[model samples]
Target: MAEEKAAENTAAQAAPQVQMRVLGQFIRDMSFENVMAQKGVSGDVQPEIAVQVNLDAKKRSAEHQYEVAIKLNLKSKAKGLEDILFLCEIDYCGLFHVEGVAEDQLHPFLLIECPRMLFPFLRRIVSDITRDGGYPPVNLDNIDFVALYRNELMRRQAEAQKTEA
Candidate 1:
């Protein structure tokens, strides 16, 4: 029993530990435009709103620290009118510390896990900004980080193939 306990302790000590922590979060930039606010447009006209989201990550230091940024661009325009109703752009970033993750898994971890951690705050900011800008709150849908990452990978692969061709 003592030998078995010692073996288990040794195995536990030899196992690598993984840890992820958010150090800080901030808005890198924000822009809002109410293009038709002064035009006195009727409330009956509903505009089509388009939202785009992009993610980026960079290593902050030689250590396992990284900065992940989520960029959101939103534009709303009346269905048949060329005039835009409102536009919003926001860049939200988070500082993350990841330790003991394998080198091969690090890229996905940063792109997927870090953004997943920061998305709720980004969503809230978008909602608040749109509401405060005189329109209904823009509640962003939940993001699928894994799907995004996979799509990005496929895009890059296609680009590489195109270059080779």
Candidate 2:
């Protein structure tokens, strides 16, 4: 019985491991508006920044291939006066060839892991855009993908419940 158990364990251990490769990454769309440059601001300005993030994943026509995209909307304004400072919007996407991930877990894996992989490139773009737009570079903080996924699930559930009621 012990020998049989050992053989079973060995077989399970030999199962294929997950494999993921980034085929490519690119900016699907981007826009930056320097409101401060357009409408000059007078006095001391304290900038307040707001950022919104949205993620999407879709299967490509090719087998084991997926496309993951992230949309970022950023706005900056003077704190007290609420005068617009700048607005930046970007849609970035990555093409991934994935294998060995279980189908049940593929959704979260694509949404979370894929974005985590692409974030650094996206951050660099944001920093450059802000600095070139005449403001100091805005470095974004690290995102918590797990929390983001959970919040999205909860939001969808709440919306569904509201509609059903």
Candidate 3:
């Protein structure tokens, strides 16, 4: 029994431990255009907003370092009219030092987990920008990273299938 216990301990020691750290985070690019102000349009504001999110991840030149970015696009318009309200676009990125994640899992970890860490900061920026832009603060809904990842995978698979056919 003692020998078996020792063997188990040795096996555990042989496995690599996972470590992840956020080295830094920042907005790579951002733009806010107040279309209503730009056009000098005046009317009752019943706003309908559309949001799109895209994520990208790439390994940095440094070992165990990766850069992940989230691109957010938002357009707001009056609910019943064709007049525009505002447009906001931002690309937020994080620098991460990651080690010990399996090769197969690294891509998902970078896209999903890194974004989850950086989202609150990005959300705050969006809220501030909207409020300062003369519109009500737009508090973003919480993103579902896992669902996003799965959907992206499904999209890629469908595209590949279309290409092959």
Candidate 4:
């Protein structure tokens, strides 16, 4: 009976209608700037950027939905106070299928899975742009998308509470 139940559970999980997921991806936008940086660094420019990554996710359609786009903007500077070393904007997009998936599962697919897949590519682009712009390669630390999403939720909740108060 236990073996039969396990088989039944596996069959249920294997159903095509029960799984919704992101499939493939393409780049929507990528831009890099460094003219000011070239002159302003005044030295090797060993850049230290105040990196602020803001992530946004949405479903583009109704059917097996899309995880939508991941946008990253980086503004770099040399020393503590200096002109813009460079500003890079990377927009990474992916195909996501969400039909038959719970809203809870879908949420992580967008915030975690989609970005996780795109992050390495985004990081590479950022590094290459910086290197090509005549600076040392920019290496970014790993991002925790789950934590970011949770913080975004808490921030929205706080704003809602503030409005209520």
Candidate 5:
């Protein structure tokens, strides 16, 4: 009886229930304007673009979980003509099971690579959208995920400092 109880207890304890945590993550939001690219140079007309980025974060129900969301807004024009062809927002997150990890490791995992994993898929979708728009493919620039994360940290710190002061 004792051995059976011990075995049961061991099995329960050995079960993988360490809990999930976001060690770190990275996110990227970009836009490509192939129509503008084509008509601007080809038609000898200047193509103007307005690009903006918004970042946000949230916590999941799990004890050690987090999500960093990036939103991108882009608009293109040709010689003051309307070309509002692309409007998109990418909201995706990774399920990270993190335990026994240091903060240094966790931060980068959530801030840098997580977004990198989701970016390719998002990019492919955006490229296809542009291609289908009867223009060349809109390839996104390689993102500086590390820099973006650092900037977010700095901005948050600055806001906190202001609040405290």
Candidate 6:
């Protein structure tokens, strides 16, 4: 019995206990506008589209819970036309249970992995909203969170260097 108990404890220690789960998802804020609805849908005009994405995370409680938010802003306008075609902004958030992540790894896991997990649902909401607003679905491309994180780090470094100089 002593040997068995020792073996079990050893196995438990050797195995990394990591758990990540999405507890809930919600749209904190959403806005959709079709500014030129009166002008009607113009098939010939190819509008310019701009999209921006940002991620933020915060600790919800002491029990290894986190809330991650993904913000998406989209704007569309015709090249020559003065009126805007459409605008969409959404702040989508997810409550997550994260455990067994090292302190150094926590930032990346929250920013990259948590957002990656929530992205598909957020994308779907954007698409559906756009389509319902009388425009074609604005399909969002898959985000490269790793690249984004690196770029953010570089930007911060540049800013720090500028301040020091």
Using lDDT, give the best candidate's number: 3
Alpha-carbon RMSD, candidate 1: 2.5
CA displacement after TM-score superposition, residue 129 of candidate 2 (Å) = 0.5
User: Over the stretch 16-49, how does candidate 1's per-residue lDDT look in tens digits?
Assistant: 7989999999999999998888777757657788
- lDDT of candidate 4 at residue 159, scale 0 to 100: 100
lDDT of 3: 0.95
Relative to the true structure, how large is the alpha-carbon lDDT of every model?
Answer: 0.92, 0.94, 0.95, 0.75, 0.60, 0.90
Model 1 misplaced stretches (Cα beyond 4 Å): 1-13, 38-40, 80-82
Query: Against the true structure, whose TM-score is highest?
Result: 3
Report the poorest 10 consecutive residues by lDDT, candidate 1: 38-47
- lDDT (10s digit) by residue, model 2, range 18-100: 99999999999999999988876666678899999999999999999999999999999988766899999999999999998
Pairwise lDDT winner, candidates 3 and 6: 3
Candidates ranked by lDDT? 3, 2, 1, 6, 4, 5
lDDT of 5 at 16: 49
Candidate 3, residues 1-165, lDDT tens digits: the string is: 999999999998998888999999999999999999988987679889999999999999999999999999999989988888999999999999999999999999999999999999999999999999998999999999999999999999999999999
lDDT string, candidate 4, 15-54, tens digits: 6465545587777888888857456546665566767777
> What is the Cα-based lDDT of residue 89 in candidate 4?
83
Q: What are the clashing pairs of model 3? A: none
Model 5 gets an lDDT of 0.60
Candidate 2 is scored at a TM of 0.92
lDDT of 5 by residue, 1-165 (tens): 999999999998776454444454443444444544454445444445465555455556876666766565556565576764344444444556556446666676566766666567656765676667654556667667888878888999999999999
